[model samples]
Target: MASPLLRKPSLVHEGDATIVHQLLAQDTGLEYVGFKMIDLKVKARYEETLTDQECCIVALTGRITVSEGEHHFTGIGTRESVFEKKPTDSVFVSGGKQFLLEAVTNATVALCYAPSLQQLPTRWIKAGDVGVERRGKYQNQRMVHNILPDSDPSASSLLVVEVYTEGGHFSSYPPHKHDQDRLPEESFLEETYYHEVEPHTGFVFQRVYTDNRSLDETMSVEHRDVVLVPAGYHPVGVPDGYTSYYLNVMAGPKRIWKFHNDPDHEWILARQ
Candidate 1:
């Protein structure tokens, strides 16, 4: 079964306002993998700049205009429908430089980055590009976003995927793990889950831990709750009432994210 690993939201102060950041993994004592999920409310006509970091933003609600110097990035406006995997208009700020932003309307955004400004090959995969598939006994249909390809043998350093789960369905059930880098089926890779629950209501459950030493944590993960996987098996499960959508951010020395499951439930793999 998948165990539980969760960290409380950390408060990050920027300008005169405040933003809540859910830190999933860090490169220091916390973990060499750097990851974070941030919720930002862009005030109308309120523009902010970023520097000394490489970042990506996903609009949660409302609309905003992102600018880099004279360059402009107009996001999909509200009431016009938001599309995933659309152009992520990106900006690079090396050595502590700031980038600029302005909100055409009140908006919330998610931003992610590495501390040293190390740029990972980033791409914007529209939700349209992901082929929806069913996994686990629940037969929950979900759209999986693959951030990295398996063709490059050297490219197995970090594997990232986002799953948009429909309401009233379950994913990551019959919990499994890849903590043992032993056989062809078992390869350990740290993982992270940044969830965006629809309607901003209800909760989801996520588990993580070693095979015999399972630990469970149930969090009311809403629009921006982040779950971390440091050194064990992790699986994310959503309840029946809410449509849970999450972005999985993973990074490790080995690029592959292979795993073994508790024999008790491993049989479910055959159905997939």
Candidate 2:
């Protein structure tokens, strides 16, 4: 079950004094996934030492240099904003290591974290290096960028991905759920959505609910709003004339991303 903190979203704004805005803390009824958004001003920096969690530093805009132990990764971004419709770069660092980032230009970075004991080598994933799949059809059509997919065995529990939908289109459709431990058919997982809408003034709708109706919420979301999922079938929709983009951080007992679609919407997949 999700705590009240998980049910309510604490938005991080660019003008805020805090450099790091954490969406899920230890008290948020989450065991695996932890999320944060960091903004760095020119010549400014952010640093952390991950003793229990591994993380992926995904660039939302500008360029930054990431230092992990003896290795350094530079020029880690290009797009001016997520609305630019271009895939950005990301750097992954293992647990038990010191992570440092400095902004060469003003930048915003999404931090996806998951608890783990294993340590993987720090690696960079460029925009061109990620696979892009156009999913759904008509208004349901959207783009999916597979990052840290199950195909890679380096990380123990984190699964990262990004989704973008055109104006008036629906994404995260079919209302899928991975809250149970039913393997092969479904996997138990916790997820968090960090959102950004194009034109800055745009908005989206996200619904989190359980089958027995024990938990349910349909939220009106704006730029930089976050949604946390502890156990539920989640779906998202965007209004007309506005594009939608969200970075998803997921973790669970298993690294696989098998989900159960709502039975009512399961038939829609057959039509596609």
Candidate 3:
């Protein structure tokens, strides 16, 4: 039997005939985070109104124009491919805001969502505005692009980021969990990982497990697959010869993020 946490890619045609893969939220048992992968052709347009949630639209590849009310952002993408190791353009739309996305070229986008009652101003997050950092060392090394973090007040609850792991590397390692709402100690956040591999045929391994081993599952993730982490210590490992890229969306009752690494594996962090 396949793990319920792993969501395989399936096409759902929207009104504009855009190819969309709905991943998190919507009957997935996740309370906060929701995700969708959209593919659009040149000149294609998709309009939407976020009634009760805030959204971050990430341009994964190619170029696109986003319009919110009277304001329009033209030619808002930079990277031609995610593997280019460059930060791409993104837009943040708060609740009750209506927006339109028009593809300037064939493009792929990620829509990350979190419920919110507060209506914040719409902001275009340029590629240059994204904070890029190289995290970990040696085999655990990975590149991180912070599209929207807790420090950014632009969002009410949504926290978004993307990570790139080299082949034979580990990501989200040392296994951390944020399932408890203990304020400064840890926060209860629901998270979703949308995976994409460099060589489409390659695969990666992700494990979601709790302290008791009651909720434990190791998933063989493929291109465009999404893994949901409702509550657990989650870690990812990339096989040799296959690079792994994942876009993460997280949210909780509190907008802050505080995680606790698994004690058994915490020793790895102390190693020189």
In order of listing, the candidates' clash counts read 20, 0, 0
Cα lDDT, model 2, residue 15: 38
Q: Which stretches in model 1 have alpha-carbon errors above 4 Å?
A: 1-4, 8-17, 22-29, 41-55, 65-72, 76-98, 114-138, 147-159, 180-187, 214-223
- Could you give candidate 1's per-residue lDDT for residues 1-272 as a string of tens digits? 22235444567756532465545333323342445433335554334343433444444445666655555666533321222422222222322334445555555555544333343332333334434444444554566644333332222243445576666665665566755667467666666677766567667776665656655455555566677666555556666666776766554444566666667766766773
Candidate 1, TM-score vs. the true structure? 0.67
lDDT of 3 by residue, 1-272 (tens): 99999988788777544555675566598889888888888888888888888999999998999999977989889888889989999999998889899999988989999997587888999899999999998899999999999988999999999999999999999899999999899999999999999899999999999999999999999998999999999999999999999999999999998999999989998889
Candidates' lDDT values, in order? 0.51, 0.82, 0.91
The segments of candidate 3 whose C-alpha lies over 4 angstroms from its true place after superposition are: none
State which candidate has the highest TM-score: 3
TM-score of each: 0.67, 0.92, 0.97
Model 3 / residue 145 / CA error / Å = 0.1
TM-score of 2: 0.92
Q: Which ten residues in a row have the lowest lDDT in candidate 2?
A: 1-10
